[model samples]
Target: MEITGNKFALIGLGDFGAHLAMVLSEKGAEVLAIDQNMDNLEEVKDSVAHTVCLDATEEKALMSQGIDEYDAVIVCIGDEFEETLLVVTVLQSLGVKRIIARATTPRHAQILRHLQIKEVILPAVDAADRLANKLLFQSKLSSLELSSDYEIIEVDAPDKFVGKNLRELELRVHYDVSLITIKRIELKPRLLGGTREVEHIIGIPSPDTVIERGDVLMLFGKKESVQRMMAD
Candidate 1:
């Protein structure tokens, strides 16, 4: 998360925005947090490099702060779409290089697109999609957004492949996919109950590494390639 030499301006000091600012600061980025609410500003005063109390819709106040110099700006206001749009417009007009906005609904996202906002995030919708996929698939596969055509997935190890070495399977050549990580799990039970241990294999495993039952593998490649691999 440490983005060296990156300066970020976060508008809005709500829960999401405040947490983002803290993360960015922890990652070695200089974060400037802005909010009209004095309480919000006070809450994150010590978390970020700078905390300012100002209406983000006010162009003059924003311009006075020289936010244009920052590398990136994120608009995290959720409730007021008008204020969000105004802030995005003002930031774009000020020549901000990269602007990322959070939108609540699809309609709001469309408005941001019409204004030519480069990045719009719908966290709730995306989370719901992930959750739904997890429940329906029940195959340990999770959602991945790589591109219009390609996707990465994480899934439990296939039953047939268990106890086999990577070299014997030839995953990359045969399936056109790459394993990224092996997720391992270790369980500790109470003294009264017997203990159990579980591990999930993931990623491009070493050729010598042995695949076991109940392991999880994180794979990355084109969707078609991934499907072919899983089928094999």
Candidate 2:
């Protein structure tokens, strides 16, 4: 998605932060990548809008870079919890528009929450969860957690769902799950001759929309509700 003109500051150019910087830049956001290590700075310097090697915990150094002016500042110092917390606190004191911090553990997350940081990311834990989901659910293509209770998952349509219209399925009433959209495969002719399959989303499906074979359903609901729907 294009996020042109949006500005973001990422403090700590660890693996997660570096990757995030590249992604944000690719999406057309202006990203400032920061880290104390020159090596880390060098890695993302060409990708992001700017790269600076400076200790984030130092308020003066951060202020000099206008950290508070950005749309958001993400603290990604994963190795050192103390340093992460300190940097977050400094960002808070600087009156940053938004602050997101990375927590290495549950306890670390709790501490960040106590510090009144609204957004905390546990990248390792999230990655593990996603991997577990992929391993456990054969039909599921991907899943995104919106919160502890809710998730949006993409799954191959079950046998019973094919040829059935949404109204006939009564997904919301019976399954307690919402089908956000449907992805269908269509064949497009290639320049040489034969056709190639391309997956396209049929946006905002209606009650009469029928599910075709090989359709991928994007469903959103409580984890248990979604699991029940898929199971049945």
> Of the candidates shown, which would achieve the greatest lDDT relative to the real structure?
2
TM-score of 2: 0.61
Estimate TM-scores for all models: 0.59, 0.61
Candidate 2 stretches with Cα past 4 Å from truth are 1-5, 139-232
Per-residue lDDT tens digits for candidate 2, residues 1-232, read: 1122489999988898999999999988999999999999999999999988888989999999999889888888878999998898889899997888888877788788788876777777656644664475544444443777787877899998999999999999998999999877676553333233455668999999999988889888887887888898
lDDT of 1 by residue, 113-227 (tens): 7788746766676566446644765554544346776666777888878889888988888887887776655453422232223332344568887877556777778878877
Best by TM-score: 2
Return model 1's CA RMSD, one decimal. 15.6
| RMSD for each of the candidates | 15.6, 15.9
Residue ranges of candidate 1 with Cα displaced over 4 Å: 1-5, 132-138, 141-232
**lDDT values of the candidates?**
0.77, 0.82
